[model samples]
Target: MLYFIAPFIGWFVSGIIKFIINYIRFGEEAKKRIGNGGFPSTHTTIMTTTTLLIGLAEGFLSPIFGLAVAVTYIIIIDATGLRMHVGKHAYILNRLERTNKGETTEALRESMGHTKVEILGGLILGTILAFTLNIIFKV
Candidate 1:
C-alpha cells in the first residue's frame, strides 16, 4: 500500500484551514460550526484524498483504484445527499421544539452533511493534497 498518509493529513489539515478561514469570516462560533458539515466537507476531503491517492499509487485502471473510486462515490453521496436530510430535519425539529416550548438545553446536531459547494471545496482540497503528496513522494 502507498503510505496512505496524504489522505489522513489532508483530511485534518484542510478542515483546520477552512475552520480558521471560517473563524476569520464569522467569528468564534464559526470555529465550532466549521467542525462539521460546512464548506469543504471533512468527510469528502478524506474520501477524495484516499481515492486520488489510490489512483496515483496504483494505476488508475487498476482494480484497487476502481474500488477506491466506488467507495468514495458512495461516501460523497452520503455526505451530500442522505445526511443532508438529517441535518435539515434536525433544524426543523429544533425550531419546532423551541416554538412549542421554551429553549431547551439539549439540541439536535444539524451538521450532518455537505452542500454542493461544500463538497466541491472538499474535492478541490483533496485533489490538491493527494496530488501534491503523490508528486513529492512519487509513490
Candidate 2:
C-alpha cells in the first residue's frame, strides 16, 4: 500500500507545487508545466518518494531497496542530463524556427528538464513527504 500511495502522493504534491509556482511566475503560460519541467521535478519526486518508502519498508540493505535506489539514480540522471540537453536543443530549434518561419508554426517545447535548483527542490519535498508518510502510515 505504501508503494502505491507514495508515488501517487509524490506526483500529486509535486505537480501542485509546480503548477502554483508556474502560475505565479508565467501567468497563462503556466499550463505548460502540467506536462513537464518546472521548479520541482515530478519524476524526481516520485522516484525519490517511492525509493525511500521502499527503503523504509524493506530495509535499506534489502535487494528491493537497492533496486529502488538504482532506479531513482537513473531518473535523476535523465532529468539533469539527457532531458536537460534535449530542452536546450528545443530552445535553439524554437529560436531558429521563429527567426526563419515567423509565427506560422508552434514553438518547440523548451522546458523538458529540471535545473539543479529544481531537482534539489524535488529531493527536499520527496524526503519530507517520505518521512511524513512513513510516520503516518507506520510502514
Candidate 3:
C-alpha cells in the first residue's frame, strides 16, 4: 500500500507546488481555463514520478525504462509543440476578431500549453523530484 501510494502523493504535492510557484511568478497570467505548461508541468510531474517509482520498483535497466522514457518524450513534445501551436492559433484568431470591429471577437482561451523552455524546466524539475524521492525512500 505504501509503495503504491508514494508516487501519487509525490505527484500531487509536486503539482501543487508547481502551480503555486507558477501563479506567483506569472501572476494572473498563469491562470488559464484550459491547457497545459505553466512552470513545472503537472503532466510531467505525474508521469515522471510514476515512471521513476516504477523503475525503482521494477528495475531501471528493464524494458520498462525504455517505455517510460518514450512516454515522457511524447508527452513533452505534445505539450510544447501541438499545444503551443494551438495557443498561437488562438491568439491569431483573437487578433482577427478584434480587427473585425469586435463582432467575431471571441476570447479564445489562451495558454493552450507551455513554451519549450517551460517544458524543459518541467522535465528537469520532475527528474530531480523523482530522483530525490527515490533516493530518500530507497524505493
Candidate 4:
C-alpha cells in the first residue's frame, strides 16, 4: 500500500514544484501556462521517480532496475527527440495555414515536450528526490 502511494506523492510534489517555478519564472501574464516545457520535465520526473523508487526497494542491480532504466531512457529520448521534432513540424504547419488563410486559427501547440537539457535536469532531480525520500522514510 505504501509502495503504491510513494510514487504518486513524489509525482504530485514534483508537479506542484514545477508549476510554481514555471509561474515564477515566466510570470502570471505569460502566454504559456504552468507545466510548459522549459525546466524540469514532468514526464521524466514522474517516470524516473517511480522507477527509481521501485529499483531501490527491489534492488539496484536487479532485473527491475534494468527494466526501469530502459523505460526511463525511452521516455526521455521521446520527450527530447521525436516530440520536439513533431512540435517544430506543427509550428511550421500552423504558420503555413495562417499565411494561406490570412487569419489565425485556433490550433493547439504541440511543442509541449522538454528539451534534452530539460530531460537531463528532470532525470537528475527525480533521482535525487526518489533517493532522498527513500532514505528519509527508510522505505
RMSD of each: 1.8, 1.4, 2.9, 2.3
Which pairs clash (backbone N, Cα, C closer than 3 Å) in model 1?
none
Q: Rank the candidates by TM-score, best first.
A: 2, 1, 4, 3
In order, candidate lDDTs are 0.81, 0.88, 0.72, 0.76
Off by over 4 Å in 2: 101-103
- Candidate 1 per-residue lDDT, tens place, 71-111, comes to 87898889888899999999999888888756576778898
Residues 39-113, candidate 2: write the lDDT tens digits. Answer: 889998998888888888889999999998898889989999999899999999888887794555777788888
**What is the per-residue lDDT of model 4 for residues 1-139, given as tens digits with 9 covering 90 to 100?**
6567766766677677676777787777344655446567877877788788888889988898899889888988888888788778878888788779577677657656787778877788788878887898787
Deviation from native of the Cα of residue 3 in model 1, angstroms: 3.5
lDDT of 2 at 83: 92
Better of 2 and 3 by lDDT: 2
List TM-scores for all candidates, in order.
Answer: 0.89, 0.94, 0.76, 0.82
- What's the TM for model 1? 0.89
- TM-score result, candidate 4: 0.82
110-132 in candidate 3: lDDT tens per residue? 57777766666666766777777
Q: Per lDDT, what order, best first?
A: 2, 1, 4, 3
- Most accurate candidate by lDDT: 2
Quote the positional error of residue 126 for candidate 4 in Å: 0.6
By TM-score, how accurate is candidate 2? 0.94
Lowest summed lDDT across 10 adjacent residues in model 2 is found at: 101-110
